[model samples]
Target: MLCFRFCPVPRLELVLLCLVLGAARSCALELNLTNSEKATCLYAKWQMNFTIHYETTNKTYKTATISDHDNVTYNGSICDDDHNVSKIAVQFGSGFSWIVNFTKQEPNYFIDSISFSYNTEDNITFPGAKDKGIVTVHYSEKVSIPLNDIFRCSSLLTYEENHVVQHYWDVLVQAFVQNGTVSRKEFLCTKDKGSTTVAPIIHTTVPSPTTTPTPKEKPQVGNYSVSNGNTTCLLATMGLQLNITQDKIASVININPNSTGFTGSCQPQTAQLRLNSSIIKYLDFVFAVKNENRFYLKEVNASIYLANGSVFSIANNNLSYWDAPLGSSYMCNKEQTLSVSGTFQINTFNLKVQPFNVTEGKYSTAQECSLDDDTILIPIIVGAGLSGLIIVIVIAYLIGRRKSYAGYQTL
Candidate 1:
């Protein structure tokens, strides 16, 4: 079973071997300089799109184009276990050089610090040509940008060659450098590039409530009247007529004599009445004598005199002979006066009486009356003898009473 002896590799040799492997894995690569010549042999442009981040700044997305160049190189590599990179250098052919530092290393990509240098061409000298500057591409995890902020980028170079002419090459490099940032200030892209629209705001206002007044009656018109006694009796009447074509008699009063003589041997017979001028249109007065107590129902003779000087008489001796009569008298002995008055109607009339015979055992007396001044007034009169008797009685009473008191003795 035995006879197997194992020899350990030397530390130095193992180290060397590891270094060789690492170097092999980290070997810098150069892209074929003439790979794009089949498409266009003339000087052409190139663009790079990338995203980056820095510990002190925010994430950024950028696009850059190289407009002018004769040659360029793109070089990058991952760091090794020792944080050392074998391709941590950039070579601008024809003796130009730059130092590079790998800041990040991932499974498929890396970010690096860049240094710059210049190389001279044999016969061509680009005016103001010092050296193209180095641009650092920091690594980032994000692929998008904010709407209001800006994304910035440094200039970068890409290289190509002409296969048709050996040793002829071209470099695409940015002609102008933008040292600052670019803003994401554009309106959002839409499916239809030709159309754009904005929404409108709707506003409304409320209204207040309002108030709304109420609607008065008319008066009625009527009539009134009064009367007091025979002889000096007074009467007044009042009324309202809306549409009166002819005259309206609102009140009337009359008196007549019975067939029993109105006079006796000792006194003269008399009767009196008054009426309202305000309510009556026409009025007349007359008197007569009849044989019965129901004289007003018996036949009689009479004459009527109106305030207008109109004379009306009834000689038939019939009780109804008088145009209008007081309650129970058969004869209209005298014509009486009637007065009518109001805002719309006014009138007046008179009455007179004559006694033909007298009997001695009876005496006749006269009455006195007053009327409403506001409405109307009417007065009736007998012979002047009765009036004279009234005055004589008043005077004699005063004089005899004075004389008797003066002669009287006090106890």
Candidate 2:
């Protein structure tokens, strides 16, 4: 009896200990890159300081920097030849993610871009920014690394701004690289060095532009998927542009699946893709099975947060957009828009959607949207007419050439 009582207590303590350890685990900034042959190409150790300059309600500028050691967790990493790009991502704070992309250029691979996205409803806040949703900043120039040498650029800072807030990156990067067999050599970017080392490469800080910066454009199209355990359930590729109205003012938002947070339920006959925005409070897109073998977008739900801390809710459940048969996808390459309400609208461009019944983690077939059929048919008819005319002209030219050859007794 004593063994039974004490054994349960120890098992409970073990379970609680595991939970504590799991919660205490944090992410490291170390990353690796490999080529298509499964050979190591690059090794990087990096940490970043993101500082945001925002104007408070009293018209005073204030700055905040993200703490790297506090609440940062590594999301995932990918290196593929499909785009010749390598990526590693981390989620910090509540709803903020930072992704770094690297690209190969002949004998060297360099940092291609860096993207930072944050939800307004989360920990990070841009006080005076006119634009909302996921805010992304891209580096126009490359940060390169040489072969067999470690590129250390600890002094280079990048500055960018949107309509309201200014953003800055103070990144410390040390990457070892090579052309064939990857190796590491110490090369510094700092001005102070000992007598034994070679001359260091210097980098200047990027200056702020003089002109007023336009709002950053969000990604409108991407291929996105979701899985349960080891099985794939949802696969879709679509372009999404949203128009939202508040207080008679309209704002356009671009939806990039990579930067947006995704959560949904996938059942046998029903599936959903809920995209929650850090800028917007809550957003949802619903797709359901209909007509036995067909599925269509059935609803849209959103709760827009206002400036005064109030919520504005909008939804439309009577939508039947983008209907396609099971095991196939619906495609429309033309531009189209669907009106959900007086205050909400969704626009699509070069669209392709498959929300249910995917097999082998891929779309099995395609069913073009009816609205796009007429647009495609007109181009096909015009091309056929032009081809027929060209054929007639070619035949006439051939006959003329034969007659001339016969008259001259030429073979």
Candidate 3:
């Protein structure tokens, strides 16, 4: 007896092959261009109407408008054969529509070309017909006309009805202008094809005016200075002086007169506004250093000491504002002094002061000295106790010796 055998193909492989074939078959629509014969007049004015049709079986749709460049449209129709159609309508999202109108004229001696552009609208459907509840569909197309091709054939003037056509026209116009082939002139004199008249001259007459000279405003005076010790000082408004002292080696003082009060003990090299006090109404103290007696005051070196017993130093690399460096340093016992000097309003002076240092050794010596005194008193107390104990032992020994002598006598 003979047996028969059968084999089945996988469903997934078959579906994939079908999908690839469908994708390969799907291609963009090709645009058709109409050619025209050359004419002797070089330029002829003619009115033409063009219609663009958008069709889709999708029912959830609305009407929209077209692009505004080159072509005028109304109700989905552009210029009529006699240029009677004043507008054209275009559609957008969910079938929205729009219309616009404009006119163009060409010189009789030169060949003229025309083109149109349109705006595209995408249609999307949600809660799809099948198990999947959403679907997106995109529809985008454009039409363009090259300057050389435009002039070559009058029939080829119409461009594709798409959104990007105007951009293409803009590029074409720029290229034409740059290549010196075309020049755009404003038709100011010719409102219509009519008679000519003499151009009018516009003139302005000046009346004899009274002269009340106003004095120029003087420059507001202000002065600001930051020291190497990170101290900041500001003098503003009728001798209003403010001084900021560093409490610690790394203490940065900011004096902002415009603000409520001073801000201090900030990190060095921090790009924070320390002192904002201005000598004048508008002049405020900015972090900057000045030079005097060949000394450079750098602003970036401004720093302050932290209360946590840690030294905070400011980076002094950037010196755009001032020549002096403002920063802080940590020291054991040595007084941390910040020396700040600058010339403000032709007055030069240097300010110096010690900042607060919270290091461990700051009060250690005094504390150690106090502890040593306590130890010295303890030694004296111990010596007195030992003497009292020796006195007691001597008394006891004397009593025992007396008792022994008495016993010997009794014997």
Q: Output the better candidate (2/3) by lDDT.
A: 2
* Model 2 spans > 4 angstroms off: 1-218, 306-310, 374-411
Candidate that would win on TM-score: 2
Question: lDDT of all the models against the reference?
Answer: 0.23, 0.56, 0.25
TM-score of 2: 0.42
lDDT of 2 by residue, 1-411 (tens): 011111112111100010111211212244445555545444555434454433345533334444333454444555543455666565667567877777766565677776776654333455554334565655454767553456554442333433212122122333323453545465554422321222211112211232211233544687767777687788766777777665443445576554455556688777777664433445677888887888998888986533222346898999988888888888888777778887788777777767777678877778887777887888899999999999999999999999999989964
TM-score of each: 0.15, 0.42, 0.15
Best-matching candidate per lDDT? 2
Q: Write model 3 residue lDDT over 1-411, tens digit each, in one string.
A: 112122212210000001111211211111111112111111111122222323224422122222211211123322221332222233333333333332323221111323343333333321221222122222232223232222211111222232111111101111112122233431221211122322111001111132211222222222322223434322112122222222211111222222212223323323222321111112222333224211122342323211221222333443342222222221112211222322111111122211212132121111121222357888889999999999999999999999999999999
**What's each prediction's clash count?**
37, 2, 58
Could you tell me the lDDT of residue 359 within candidate 1?
22
Instruction: Give the distance in Å from residue 22's predicted Cα in candidate 1 to where it truly belongs.
Output: 36
lDDT of 1 by residue, 118-145 (tens): 3323113222323333333322222132
The collision pairs in model 2 are 119-278, 120-278
